[model samples]
Target: MTTLRIGNASGFFGDRFSAFAEMVEAGVDVITGDYLAELTMLILARQKAKDPERGYASTFLSQLTEQLHTIAGSQARVVVNAGGMNPAGLAEAIRTAAHEAGLEIPVAHIDGDDLTDRANTLGLGTPLAANAYLGGFGITEALRAGARIVVTGRVTDAALVTGPAAWFHNWAREDYDQLAAAMAAGHVIECGMQATGGNFSFFTEIPDLRRPGFPIAEIEADGSCVITKPAGTSGAVTAETVVSQLLYEVSGARYAGPDATVRLDTITVTDLGDDRVRLDGVRGEAPPPELKVSITEIGGFRQEITAYLTGLDAEAKADLVQAQFAHALELSGLPRPHNMEWTLARTDRADANVQEEASARLSLVARDRDPKTVGRQFANLLVEFALGTVPGFFVAAPPGEASVYGRFRPGKVSQSEPIHRTHHDDETSLTIPAPTEFRGLEPTSLDAHSPAPANGRTSAPAGSQTPAPAHRSGTTDVTLPLGRLFGGRSGDKGGTANIGLWARTEAAWQWLRSELTHDALRRLLPEFADAALDRVELPNLRAVNFVVHGALGEGVAYGARFDPQAKGVAEWLRSRSITVDADIAGSVNLDDFFTAEHTPASASSGSDAAAGES
Candidate 1:
């Protein structure tokens, strides 16, 4: 058996470089560096503005230079997407560094995702904001280029290791079933050393965490890799830890990828060889024909304030006083929230009767696209209820600490823009070169067009607030951030657009009607309201099946389309009152689920599909 040593240095782009060096020192077969975050794409987009040619990402090249000549070739390679928006530039830079070190190494550039060209003018007119996918096959090409250190832009986070392993082992592209198997192995190992106990939280004890080495995946042609950490490290490799991590990182009903909509249920784990567990049974559906780009728009702001409310009968007093304040606010024609997030801290040492004075926070879940509205309303609420029983249950609202939050959606920039996904198949044939001259490379976005220029000193575009005049001649609609709307695509990032959140009862919508424009909805919606909502019998409340004739958004009642009316309806129906939901988020990794399942007492509180709004 050929043994390969692999390691990862940095946890993120802003992480320490010493980790990689330590891994090299520890004799890892390959050094994999993970430096991208869910929000890193936005950061790279910003960086590209300042130096279009340099593009957005430059961390990997600089970091690699720091360890150059010092790193001996024990088959230790650097794989990272710290290249961000500019993988080609980083690849070129790596070659240059190798040349400076007098090494005649071949460098590979896996170029294909900068979808920036169509960003300015695609999809009917709305602009494309951020465009990137775990660029597939690019890493394999880079392996083909003989790159000692490979850098790429937003490739599938897992493929950083899997692709290279596949390329070196010469895995066949025609063999997708096996390719997917290898890809699954990469997915397990992508989070750097996370697979090998570096970040496992269930450990009974940990050792030398400060200098923990990276992970290694000695993947075989059969689609399994030994889940091992660097030698001389203080970590345990067991069946429990790895499986737990796998279960934790993946969640939701669907996991979208460039090639397939993979189902996590297909995965299985077995403790086969000594200290080596076999990972197999990962299956994938063919990828969507159109690539999705996340388009973020200026939504508005949210304000929150925290307060410590403890003493004798804290819950009783908090609940009573909270009611007082809420009643007062309701009378004043203002919204009153139900729950104050209370976190218990410091034990029972300092409380009077309760002996548990937990700190509670009251937050505003605003709908308007204006920060000022949230800021002002929160400030007013704080003053009126800061010290009383009901509303006085919380205080410390951020007076004016309001900032803009971006609302994101998906749209296509191109029809399968050429993406070079590179993976390593074997290690024996890999070689490194002294940096060489790599010029004429320019950073371009795989997205369709340039996002709204952010370099200008202009603040967020002023929001448009057309006074529809409440109780006007329009029906109300609600949009819940379920499924894809919440960025819930596999390997995409966290945030599934609600992907859940539907009423359990059809009649339950009636209780929602006082706050909802059932009358107007009747005119706009033909099937439910306008068509006799009173008689519309709902099943499990899985979905409203709004036959609004013209409601929902536009003529897109059939498909997911956005019309001004739909936007208005969405904003209208999101919420007419302040409420808190239960956290139904499953045990599958870090995905989110709506917590409030008890609205009308007839809903199941959970739906697998994404709903428009509650």
Candidate 2:
């Protein structure tokens, strides 16, 4: 089969709108967009509650509506998870939009991924939405039936690319290696500009990031592919950027999808030069018997208040603010919430400087089953501190109204259940078959309580502890920030967060693996000392990924922590000074070499740093 060029436009629901048009103009064979994340499902469910026709990603349809002719003319097959909780409704909306535009694109919608009924049995609160992460088989079937555009609800992100690749290569269920390769390619480009330089640790090196081009994967029949962007796009694709993204939010050596189990240990990345990173040697195993099901349900109400502390004694002032607030709450005779978090973030820079630079923040968050407890009463109690608190005291912003939040619960369902169905534009639909054999694929990082492998390399699941690996020995040593020797990337998966740390060289990797043991990690971030923790080593990528189970306390939307999604987890770790060999610590040349070795993919690009994580 010829090489398949797949381009990804939108990473999340509200991604760059111009990406689709850019992919279309770039002449991609297939265009895809990943519009769903764990929290996004809950958001969509809330939207569906307001209006049944409003559940799907409006941006997906808007992109298609604006670029339907361009996409149809370029002979590009469009696939997106924009269907959210309503794949049928999204498909119908697209069909209607296409008709109004005087176009007749054959659109297909994949169904049966919704597991609301099955989830109800667990009694896991009032479910907002229950979705099973589906595979690419239905998409392949839809494409076989001549679907110009395919809409899916909750398929794995990589399935967007693997589906087309499977259809193009006629890959069977047993073609594990090839399928694994395609899945790797999909994973690389799935997050749009992430394959470029969006959230790279060494962001100073990449140039022309003003508007980075969306990522494209050029995959061959063998499964090896070059990850790149449009020729004139802003961001650059290099080994470091690709590796950074590869480690983002991943658990261990294995990355499981509904279609296959990809072994990250064997994955290899090579700089093919000229804005391309060749990905190869991705191996695969049979997928697990049960598919992952995301269950989002109404948790309760939450409210937060922040007080600013500046200049001398900022930490002391923050303490006073918290004390006064608690006293006020007590004097008001108001019932306390179920849970409360008081955090004093010392962002104050050292030495004499502007007050803005010396300012610290004291934040208080409350969660409860009753709205009144976390609502106006909570806000009023915080304001009472303004008069009696320390000097230079002020609220960062108004204590806004309390908001409803959703709790994320990860579960599994037998593959045989949740029948897969695909509806074609020609008024035809069919049930896609489930694999007969139970592959018994080990559960994903979702099962934080699972025992770790006996190898002692990965963390002891979440609650368990493992013996610490030996620390590296060196005669001459110096103290420097961890970022001096390692680069890191981190993000959330439901209530869990994974931080991926990598070294530039083999020697560095060895030192990192030895020095960054489970015990070392706990020492560095004592805040999560008791939180469930697991570490996975990826020697092939010179990286180690640490999964913090239940770190976010119910997930981003529901979590009251300041860094809810753990976006700053890696950055925070990097800022901590660590002892290292004097030679390694002083090797500014090594850092300089890396800066120049990997060129940016496109013109200087500007991106919303926070939103780029997903």
Candidate 3:
């Protein structure tokens, strides 16, 4: 079977600077770069407001300029969502750059995803930036039109891979299964080193993680692909690493996209040794009738102040600061903030060796519609009480003026609403139509027990003993951290966060399914006591994913929590102690798994570490 090698260079706007040159040198058929995220759109919007010609990722332009001659000399093609809020502008810029570099690379751009002008009419409220999620066919059309480089705005990240695969295979519009399989491959490599070993929960198991290489998908005509990295790369690509990326930021079995809905439950992962993992048996369904729109708006102004309380009377010191701050606000004669939240983290220890170890953190976050409420006046008020209240009352840093915060919300419109179009170098526009056949997405059902009932009760109100699982009746239980036998991956989806936990063996999976119930999770993580929760089981992957709604309030841009994106929430859950069967725990050999190592052939001895952020 003929295979198209698709490699990812840049995952986000600030990814490794040299990845594009590296991937091109690796001789891949295509290079895809994903630079836009939910928060990125908002940041670009602010940039565009300041300067009209600057909403796109500028780093891509520089990379292309530096490597234009090499790319023009190779058979490799470039596809990137770095166009961000302005595909047409970015395409024109690329053409200008190519001309200046003495290269004639054909650049094409896909647009019509921007919905800011028609937002209110389409029931999407007034937002700073609004872009609909487009399918991959526009990219396919551009590629078929003989464009060597394709620029897109706000398409599904997977479209970079699916579009190229469809174009290469001449797939029809209704080739749902093939498109879904390609989408799975795209999702794996969309974050570059993530599909490799960059953020694997079992990081200790992989060797030479420093400066891991980006991932590539050897996609075949039938939609099956081997997820692997370039030979002599630093990172390891195994079944476990691929599974970790598959579960990251996903909710249920039905992973819906603009082109097709993927049945994540049907997918099977096979390790083919030497850093190659085969993904097959994927099933897909018809595309949804409506397209998802990401809308970001300026919610309000926010300011924060953190005070370090050391030694004794930590509680009293926190109380004194809160009371003083409230009284100061009242006396300032300024309007009160719309919302105020205070958190006291007791990180101090008794008889600590260092002063830093004996201090707790008391933070105050204030938000308001009017900037003056949380602006310089608020900071000055907090500083006024530095000498009057609490012993050793000092802030971590000087509070700055309030800054604008953004809120993200999902909107939907008819798939045909946006005039999807491809602009070629010859000044011709090709319109791409929406899918003729559509289906409403339905919740995926599983044979296992249903998720905990939605009673809005965080924990069994104060006295009722939560019943234990029936499977644990006759087994000897030992208290241990969940990370001892399981691995987890987590990320934020708008305002919600998802944590996917998987076991290494079948027996461990059986124990996990029975022990980690909805109530059990709430009991373990009391911080999510009031948030709405939903749990789904994927028996094929031996994993259970939990979705916590409202965990990040409005979104990552809103700065609702300390760890706003919830990237480390899974690690926090893994640290929580839980009771497990001794047999299941003793059967696993974590030491052996961590000790086994295979050194990379051409590993670079550099200090630059790659982060796995989506």
> Cα RMSD to native, each candidate?
16.4, 6.9, 6.6
For residue 516, give model 3's deviation from the true position in Å: 1.4
**lDDT, candidate 1, residue 504?**
19
Give the Å error, residue 18, model 2: 0.7
TM accuracy, model 2? 0.90
lDDT of 1: 0.45
- Runs in model 2 with CA error above 4 Å? 122-125, 441-475, 586-614
Q: Per TM-score, what order, best first?
A: 3, 2, 1
* Model with the higher lDDT, candidate 2 or 3: 3
Residues 1-614 of candidate 3 have per-residue lDDT tens digits of: 49999999988999999999889889999999999999999999888888889899999988888888999998788999999998888999999999988889999999999999999999998899899999999999999999999999999999999999999999988998899999999999999998899778888878789989999999989899999998888988987788889988888767888889887777767777788888877778888899999999999999998999999999999998999988988888989889999999999999999999999999999999899889987878878879998888899888789999999988898999999999999999999999998866666553222333467565565222234334556688666778888889899989999999987766677777777877777777777766667787776567788898888999999999999999899898888776666777776743222112421111111101101100
TM-score of each: 0.58, 0.90, 0.93
Model 1: per-residue Cα lDDT over 432-488, one tens digit each: 221121111111111011122244211222221111223323444332322211111
Stretches of model 3 off by over 4 angstroms after superposition: 447-456, 461-475, 589-614
Candidate 2 lDDT, 1-614, residue by residue in tens: 39999999998888898888888889999999999998899999888989988788988888889998887676789989999999999999999999899998999999898878667674433487888899998999999999999999999999999999999888998787788889888888898888888987888878888888999999898888889999988888888888898988788656888888777766767776678888776777778788888888889998888878888888777777777777888888889999898888888887846877888888888889898989976787777667767887888777677888888878888887788999987789989888665455453331224333354443434323223324456456667678877889999988888999988765566667777776567657666666657777666577788998777987888874678899899998888767766655654443322233542221111111111311
